[model samples]
Target: MKSFRLFLIASLIFITNNFLFSQEEDVVEDSTETLEVYLIDNYLQGENEKILVLSWMTNLPTKSKVKIEEIGTFNVSDTLTDFHQTKIDLSNVRFTKNEYMFKIISELEDGSSVESEEYSFLVPFEEKDTSSTKSTTTSQQVKTSSSYYIYNFALGITLWLLPSPALAFENNKTKFAILKDLPLVSIGSFSAYKTFPYVYFYAGYVHIPEGFVKNSFRLGTKYLYELPEIKHFVSLGLGGFTNFKGSNGINGEIGFSFLKVLKTFEMTASYSYNYLPSSKNKFHLFSIGLFTSSFSINLNY
Candidate 1:
């Protein structure tokens, strides 16, 4: 009887140990399965809002808990399963000129935890506005400040100093001869403000140089409407260019410009047709060319 009792006790102990081992193994397997999460936001811009999403998968029958934080601040915390969507308000988020970054975290029912790699995106900002504005009053005031006058003056001077069509025609004998007999040189300056998508205005001086000495001028204003693609611009201006020496007047033109931006360069092709007054010689001036062999660099603020 003693031996039988001892054998029975040994059998019970063996069965109990096996059951405990099996339970622990099941728990380990459950913990190994974790949830996955990610963020989605591209082309974020100023005063615009965006949404961030979190997603996961689980085989367990129990509900799982998911939590999210941004830069150590709790943005979202909830019990979730299968899928979850969250909307983040980015209206006040201050993004750097070119890039933005965010972080996310997730947890599963079996006490398993997982983290996502930092996600980043690139966005381009309008550099000219930030560099040109610095005041609390009207935009016109900011634009007309003394600093702006100095900046534009310096820019114009620099252009005159550099090698341009004007300079090239004046110095080279071959170019001078070609331009001297041409009898017309058109000059224009334009300023555009892109405050919204698919809309902008251009304002500046449009002049035509006429006469043997190239001392004549034409003053005019042009209204331009750009297409949605931003690759094409059409303009109409009403003005007159005078050949003071000859007492002749040349009517203004309706012009169009097409532009293509490459990785390191920009190309522009333009055309204009002039309508002469009945008193002057009725003729047309047409031009087509490309701005190439030049480098384009973008600076951000």
Candidate 2:
């Protein structure tokens, strides 16, 4: 009878050990799969200050914590029980135009700890003031003005500079065809911050000329560096282009752009020199033009 009792106790001990080991293994797996947190705002504006929202999930009910440290400081922790909404105010934090990294850690009820992926938010400030009064005035002006006038103004300047029908004729015959190779158009959305550098995306017609008006469409990226005291920025961009005239060529350009962001309107002037190595027949077909000089009204969304 004593031997039988001893055997039963040993069996129970083995089963209990196995169950505890399995539980530990499950906890390890859960800790490895951490929660994800991200910044909601794509473009942060100065007037409407933005906040960092943290999100997470767990297999079991667990208490979590979030911490934010400015680029170079000790991590600060905040305990989070409710997983619904977590907010961090970034109003006073200042940053230059560079990558800002934040660390977040979450703790589980079982003493297992998990950390989030390194998340970054590009907080940008507009050098231009975005106010309702300025927007109203600009809106009225745009509604009253005709878009045709704007188009005509741009076309008229382009024609007046060259002023030769023969120039257009030559362009059609040679690889330098404007009509066949329509200048690539790009619609860009850009935002700037007073404390941070600015970013812009090119989507529409970005006129790229190789020599004697060779038209090409391109997708490009631009970065603007904010200067102290000055509202203008030094811009840099690089991108790829394909000619539409079936010329089969690729082009790259780099240039500097300046912006004067006013209370209501913004004026931008950019000068980029493009190089088309493929267009070089006998000599390198190198052409330089005033790439862009235009004015736009600031839009709020």
Root-mean-square deviation of each candidate, in angstroms? Answer: 21.2, 17.3
Candidate 2 residues 1-301, lDDT tens each? 9999999999999999999999999998986754444333322333346565544444433455554445443323334342323556666766554345664565655577676666665654433346533332111112336877788677745532431111112233423322111112323332222432344445333332444434556566566565757755466666555566644334333434344332322233433344545664221222222223232222221
Candidate 2's C-alpha runs over 4 A off are: 1-197, 206-213, 248-265, 281-301
Query: Model 2 Cα displacement at 201 (Å)?
Result: 2.1
lDDT leader: 2
List TM-scores for all candidates, in order: 0.29, 0.29
Worst 10 residues of 2 by lDDT: 162-171
Per-residue CA lDDT of candidate 1, range 88-183, in tens?
455554443555565455555655555556666454433445656753321111135798878866764443333212211212222211111110
* Per-candidate clashes, comma-separated: 0, 17
lDDT of 2 at 16: 100
Off by over 4 Å in 1: 1-215, 246-250, 261-279, 289-301
The number of residue pairs in model 2 that clash at the backbone is: 17
* TM-score, prediction 2: 0.29
